[model samples]
Target: MNIIKVRITVSLIFEKIFGKLLKGHERSIQAKKNIALSFLFKGLSITINIILVPITISYINSNRYGVWLILSSIISWMNLFDVGLGNGLRNKLSQTHAFKQYSRSKVYISSTYAVLLIVSIGIYLLFFLVNQFVNWYAILNVSQASIYNLNEVILLFVGFFCLQFILQVINVVLTAVHATSKVSLISVISQITALIAIYILTLFTKDSLILLVVALSGIPLLVQLIATFWYFSKQYKHLAPSFQLISFSQAKGLLSVGGYFFLLQIGSLVLFETDNIVITQLFGPNEVTSFNIAYKLFSVLVNVFTIVITPFWSAFTDAYTLNDFQWIEKIFKKMYLYWIFTIAVAVILVMISPLLYRLWLGNLAINIPILLSIAMVLYVAGFCWLMIHCYLLNGIGKIRLQLMLYIISTLINIPLAIYLGKIWGTAGVTLSNVFVFLYMDILLFIQCKKILNRNATGIWNM
Candidate 1:
């Protein structure tokens, strides 16, 4: 058939262009497949997210939407309470799966789940006790008149997030096994469900932030819960978490690595998540909305870059385990080329961003300054550049340098963000992030190069 001939012609062009680099390598082949499928799912997820933003803004005013963004950022801090177990489990499970050690992977899985479950319960209890005195309305810089149910909304979101925290471990588990496509599929389903729920709310119910929170937070949790049960019962049944496999001794190994990751998580939260809090405190919620709108627009490139490289975290683990340094070198070259492409795309997106905002948000797009879009382009470039080295280091388990850099970044970002926000408004906060990410990117790139060249020593090797 003509279709078959076209397929063959396209295959020939791909082979001719990339040549033997990906021809015989099973890791590269599998990674290509993951990238292909992830693009499909993530494309849908991105579209839904873009559509959700305008729809959400329509349902609630910009100030309330800004409050929601701030609250979500604050609640997301609790993900650190997992103490890096999720990522630790990711690296550990990837290594185990590489060696065909299913039993060992199961023990790691169960141990991580047991620890997260206990941590989630304790977090819920601790927050319940702490929530009474926190004065969240004041912290959010919103009036009680605007959101009387702020406390109840916080309580409801925390409850859903606590449960979702445990159930979402399935994502890490799937990624470890090179099943990131499934993880993307799960996210798409959750996003679709949330969109439908919100659409229904718009049809029947009055605009209530509480109901918005329920639809946004609760639906994802429900979907993840179903997926956790379904995946464990079928494809991953052999590695399901159970009381029998939960081992305190086994947990120490995960914590040993995860502990460092835990500290890094806190540092990351400070570096990335505090922008909204700072904007809300200093510039009010309206500017926060503008900052996020710009951020969301530019984040498309970051997400695409992530989809391409996500599979390589585990692939790097496999290669390093086998001492296949040449393969690592080849992949790094390919990644750099991709990074160059992202930079080009970021430039183009920045050029057309005003038109994009008009199309995406209509009148609501007026407040987002072009300066914010420019800074966001810089942020995305730094982020994509940093992720390349960071993932390889994490996969190869050389993160002491990354940990130190994040600590320094954490210390530097907040004051800089505040100082810059005062000077440049919301754009200043974003530029502050750009400065930190560029600093980290340079150092981590050095560490990655040294390790890959087999010349790293002392802290770099660590």
Candidate 2:
């Protein structure tokens, strides 16, 4: 009787262990599938963008095109308003979803949407006020002949720009809700349509660059908003916000989270986008165009890696919420290896960047090999740091530390970039990024290690 009882107990234990292993295996497979799908969409979009950029640059002279790049960079800084709301909401949703807390998930989603909408309105107002006072013409270094035209068209462009920014927040909400495939599809189609429309419009209105840019840029957001509304209304009817004001408690949570994320965004923008401004201000708009072309081409590799990792963010959040330290560690190890491999390939490509640039743009203005190779290395390092930070800190709600690191880094980036740009020109500016990313990464890793260790201990105790 004792032997029979012992055998039965051991069998039950083995079965339970086997079941868990099976579930983990299944989850790993699902994670890979999701990552691949997300990567496919982003890869296609980037490929299309690459094919179109040369044509666009050719149509609009390099100087004028550089102005576009600078304007876009300025707009990229405006993403500070997103704070970290998308990430915060994603973490919350992943946790709630894991536990089958459907009602709470709906509330969280609605609250996040409401908060983002309010923040978007605030950003719109800020943009308007800045537009009214700021001398965009001087900043862009527009020729006297073009200055009057730029001033006349600035307000109209700002309006369209604000509309596009609001749509971006809505798109973020869609991403948090795991509706990214739909968003990605809409993004690609709308962008292709807009590109085609711009090409057609240019034939008739060759001189109306501002109007062309505004129309082409704004129309895509309108399409995205329509797609978002249609999909969310049908698929997530329960999460639909009534547009009523969110409670103070909910607002506070979003803002507190977003404020930190906002700082981080500003820091990252300072590190990445400030280079163009510094280069243009120190050298000229032509140099800006040269740098941007090389940077964008090299960024294809970085962006592909980002797209591959993004879908896994929600999964990391879910695992963190469950205190699954083993799974988290395993995932991190796999991702680290993959990132290292991807970056190695990017470095190799950088060796041929000069040839690639000549083929793409015809008689490059800059040393594409040096600029792209340095930028590629900096970007790859930054990408690795970002994945670890997002998985460990952002996934688990330790964003305040990230915010602190970003603030310190931003303070460093401004002076360093300006000083470097003055001394070495564009190369100096590009080289400074390596230092900035390294500083931030080291700080983040130290903090993350402490958090992971503590959590691992807790998991073991549990």
Candidate 3:
């Protein structure tokens, strides 16, 4: 009897192992398919931008390009208005969907859109006023000592740009609702239109620098806003703007979630862009150009990975809602390994980036390869951790924790980066990123482990 029982147990164990292997393989394949589609859109965008870099460089000088980079970076800081509401909405929607609370889900979704639109408009007006009054020429480090009257042009561009950003936020909300295919289509169309506008502007205009920047920045936002509103209006008739107000109580819920995210957003902007600002101040505008070039290249790699991982936010919500911890763990492990591999490849590409830059942009001032490699490694690791933590926290409706971690990391990063940059230059600034990410990742890991332990203990007792 003992011999028979042992043999049966071994057979059962083997069967279970085989079943798990098959399931894992299937899940990985599905994940890859999703990743591939996301990557296709991202890759196309990156390729187009890469091809344009040389064309733009040939037409406009490096100094103008550096200014454009600075202005764009400043505008990117406006993402603070997002305040994590998109992810918070997605989290709530996912949870609601899991619970079959469709009515509540719609209310949450509508209220989120309402709040973001109002906040976005306010932020835009604030920026507009600042741009109008601020003597950016005095503040900015441009190659030409004279401040070109770009404030009016930049303000106009940013105003339209803000509208576009609001539309994109709506698109993100749509994406959270599992409308990524539509989002991808809209993005491609908008980008193509914007590129064509830039090309035409470049061909005709004598003032290529200003014209190109305005066309590149302004047209797409306008096009995207139009397209997004049209699409969303058509599909979700209820999403139309109306006086159907969100109660203060509901507003408080969003603010509660978003407040933390706002800090995180601020911290993120400071952490990522502070180096360029410091380099611009300490070194010069030319160094900014070199750093921007390398940073742009690194950004492409990070964006590609982000596109792949983005859809998982909604999927994670679904899994969490179903009490599927095992599935979550499996996906997380796969993503971690994939990130390691992806970052390795990114580092290798960045190692050869200087050679590519020399061939493409002539002799740049900074060591492109080293800066690119270090920044690539730091950004990939840091961004990966940020994304993973955000998704995990969002799934659990723990936006505050995510915000706290980012705030702590950002606060630490600023002083550390400033100190390091003073000592080592751009490379030292890049190294500080590794430290920031390491701290956040360690904290997140500990927190996640504790959550898992409690969850597991509860399950075991049940």
Candidate 4:
């Protein structure tokens, strides 16, 4: 009788702590599904990326591969030109959906898509013309011989990239509706398609860089475009992006909300995106590859943590709408624990990085110093920590702190990175981010607390 009583007591204790018996909580259930699906898909995406690096390096020479990374970095900035409309729409749609205001959601969706479509068309034309005057060789800091059909490569990539910013709203909508699992499902399929295209190119093509670029950019665009169409046609017919549904009022509203996000985006672009450009300008394209190789290896852990936080972005919004401060408080306590756990994971990742890099890249593996590895680990952990609150801030559309802090960080980041890159090479570039994270982690935590306490006035005001 005593043994049975002890066993029952332990089981009850475990159940209460783990919340297994309390799985009926709506927010928890949504978070659990989102986490599972995101991991499943992001896992596949990460695996494809790991394999792509080696095969792509083999297919294209080192110089060309480095140039491709630069091209990707450049195009990534184009989305920021949306001026934060996509993210604004995400939070807006989440709020409107929670209230069951489906018409407002459709208007927001239609207006944002209309704006992006116009922007995409104009950019496609602008880049097409600008490609003539711009010296790709000088911009990328690559030898002329290393680039074959330079104009064609830029044009094709820009074409796909411009379309991606617009069509990717499908994902924004899915995420807003808290159908994050569906978003992951779409991502996994897109990644698989792109991977298969690259594998085909590797086998059949010789030294055709344009063909490789086409496969990499074009195939994914085709996949995402199709998926976007399929979703709108079937599951989201009401929120479909018809030009007729576009509203100037909704556009103004998105801009009003997205304006801050746009500023934050600019700050982030400077702070984070400039690393490759700085590396290329100072160290060279080959060095950029070395930096990227180490980053990709360790970024796997960061990416996994991101999968956990991403689904919660809109979930936090839903919870906030319901005024469930207790739930938010509990979830945040759990997030803090995970942030601590991430440090241990980062340490483990840095320690094992050597053998992992060698086996993954073999002869092509670059020498990653221990300090650089540690810096990268620090950067990723800090990023994961900030994200725990960043998502909440984004969820509620209150990001003044993010706006001001990121601007300050970006102003400090560039010169600091260049100065450090000169001294420590790649490690210095990674270390520049540590300073940004320090400010972000502290301020965002405070903001989360203030918001939870319902004292979100003054500095915490929208």
Candidate 5:
């Protein structure tokens, strides 16, 4: 009788604390679970990255490390060539799953894979044809003497890049299924494996960029490949992308939705990815390292915020499809509270960054100015805010306004980044990025509110 009373009391307390937040709706329950799991996996992934960086720097020197960073950024542009099909597949697949359209889902999956495979092949053959003609050393603003096997190294990077490009669609498929935590787990595994590979290389090999590229790029691709096979053969086998299911008609529907996403991806590449190249060109590869170290430090806040919001894209899609506005409104209110909490953490992170830099980079910590850290904090704050709004709009397939906004922002970023980079160095480039994020934040916040309240009209509706 005493034990029964105690159990009843504990259950009542749990209900009182989390009844609405955790137990009210199926969507809420799934989002909460994914967010919790993402925090666990992403925390481990970030820790591995932190440990991986210093070791990599010690192994290859900061300049070469910076070169690797810039090259990786440049190659990352290849992801855009999917023409939004990945995101198209994500949103479309999510909708199909919600409606239990299993056969259509398979067609969507197969068609996306077929299209991306064709794209990857074209990209690889194009690179093979042109690899010898371009002077990579001049393009990257690195000296030939500082690097060797340059063409071969780029070829290897591109090869791995194209293959990974096709395989990583599995991540999008997982996200669409509201299994975002699984995506985070894959990332954690890949990063951990890369860290281990780098450690082994340090012990047995000379500091060769080619070998570093192989270890860093190869491991992740291998993991994703295994995941693709395992998933297709098991849990998601029914929705597997088979050759016979390739449907250009389904592909057309996906492209219709994804065209805006493709453009947005391009604009994002310019806004975010070009900073390293700008830093390397205006300053040097060494400055790129200092800038990146600071970025990696402050990006902790952005990464954490992403974990909170990542699962919500598909959640929002489901709610919108079902006309569940009240749930969307309530969740946005909670998200606002979380956003405020993130801003507080960002300020705290900046306050202690000097000590962090010292511990994180040891003697390599001398160059990161307090100003750069401050700039990064502002950049992170704005980026996180923009993400909260953008995810909702994307989830609902109302992205025309976002597409237009990105075009305007992209046009402004490159020149502004160059101009500011000349005066403020790397911090200027970051501030330029902050400006773009701030612009999007104000407009997107207004748009999200209008749409949620059913007051959206004209461009705001889109």
Candidate 6:
């Protein structure tokens, strides 16, 4: 009888705590499930990248591997072409869903897809017109012999990237609807397909970066195209993007929000993604590989934190639109504990990273300074901290301050990175971000407090 009573008491307490934590929102509970699924799938996908890195380097000389990384980085620039529609769609959908406005959500979907299709086509045409004028070899710092190879691969990659970008609206829709688990499922399948294709290409093809990129870019396209087809055909057919369904009013609404998002993406790309280019310019292509390897190891924390926070983006939108300050306050308060936990995780990752790097890279591992490792840890730590609040800001559509901070950061990043890179080399490149991004967390934290207190004005409004 004593043991039975103890079990019953424990179960009751667990249920009480969980129910309180969930705050009576079915979306909150569902978001947790989605977060778990995303973590699992992204973990698997990241593993593929980790495994591929060393294999790719060993198979294709470090210089060529660096070129591929740099070129692929450039291709990623094309993603901003959507100009924030993806995230705007997410916020719009979540807000509509919060009020049970399903029809409005469908209109947003149609308008976003229509706009994205036009943007993707414009990008391809624009690239084709300009591709001949740009010296690919000079840009990548590669030999002239590889220029033809680079040209062939870049066109293929960019074409597929545009197609994939348009198709990715399906995912934006899924993410907005808080169907992120399905999004993860699609990502896992796509990564696995890419991995298999890459493996086969390594065995059958020469060390041509073009062939390698084809495998990298093409397989994911097939997967995304198929997922888009299935979702439109069945699951989200009611909201399926049709030419007739596009609305000028809805398009204006999405672009209104999306334009800010576009500028912010450019700011982020300049601040964070340009490091590889900076390193390549200052150090060498070979050093790019070394720097990015350490980055991948430390970036695990950012990726993990991202998986945790992604669900909250749209969830925050739903609660904020509904004016659930109590729930918002409760959730943000809980995230302080998460932020502490992530800082601790960053410390632990830094501590064991040397061994982890050796095990993962074996002979391929270059000697990155312990200091650089620590800096990378701090970089992601600050990044994760900023993201916790940034997502909330994005969700609530209070992005003016966030955008302003990013613009300043972007203007300063290139010069800061170069000046620092000259003095401290690799550590300085990442350290620039650490120093610049501190403003984001500090300012955003204050903004969150002001908004919660319902006294938001001045800089908060600006």
Q: What is the C-alpha RMSD of each candidate to the true structure, in Å?
A: 2.2, 8.6, 8.3, 3.8, 2.5, 3.1
lDDT of 6 by residue, 1-462 (tens): 999999999999999867765655686787877876788888987898888887778767788888877877888787898878888788888888777787778788888888888888999999988887788877777777644566667887889888888888888888888888788788878878877877887788767777777677778888888998898789887667767778978888887888899898998898778988998999878878888888988787788888888888888898877788887888788788887898888899889988988899888746777878889988987888888888888888899999999999988999999999999998999899989988888999899889989999987954
How close is every model to the real structure, measured as TM-score?
0.96, 0.85, 0.83, 0.93, 0.96, 0.93
What digit string (tens of lDDT, one per residue) describes model 4 on residues 18-129? Answer: 5852485687777777887788889998999999898888888676778888888888888787999988899999899888888888889999988888889999998888
Clashing pairs in 4: none
Residue pairs clashing in model 3 are: none
Candidate 5 achieves a global lDDT of: 0.91
Worst 10 residues of 5 by lDDT: 16-25
Model 3 lDDT tens row, 1-462 = 999999999999989765654555433444455565666776777777776665665556566666667777787877666676765666666666556676666567667667767887887778767776777765566623433667865776677666765666567655666555556666666677767876776687654655776667766776677765686578755444444645546656866766666676787797777777777777766667777777677787678767767767777777766767787777778778878887787778777776777776664344464754676677777777767756666667555555676777766887887788788777777778877877777766666665555552331221
Candidate 2, residues 297-381, lDDT tens digits: the string is: 7778777776656656666667777777777778777777877887787777778776777787665344453754666666666
Per-residue error for 38 in candidate 6, Å, reads 1.7
Query: Model 5 over residues 60-175: C-alpha lDDT tens digits?
Result: 88899999999999998988998999888999988999999989999999999888889999999999999999999987889998897889999999999999989998999999
lDDT of 5 at 78: 85
Clashes of each: 0, 0, 0, 0, 0, 0
Residue 110 deviation, candidate 2, in Å?
Answer: 3.4
Model 2 RMSD in angstroms:
8.6
Residue 235, candidate 2: Cα error in Å is 2.6
Off by over 4 Å in 4: 1-22
- Lowest lDDT 10-residue stretch of candidate 6: 144-153
Stretches of candidate 1 exceeding 4 Å from the true structure: 1-22
Residue 110 error for model 5, in Å?
A: 0.6
| Clashes, model 4 | 0
lDDT of 2 at 257: 60
Model 2 earns a TM-score of: 0.85
Q: Tens digits of per-residue lDDT for model 1 on 375-422?
A: 998999898998999899888889899999998998899999999999
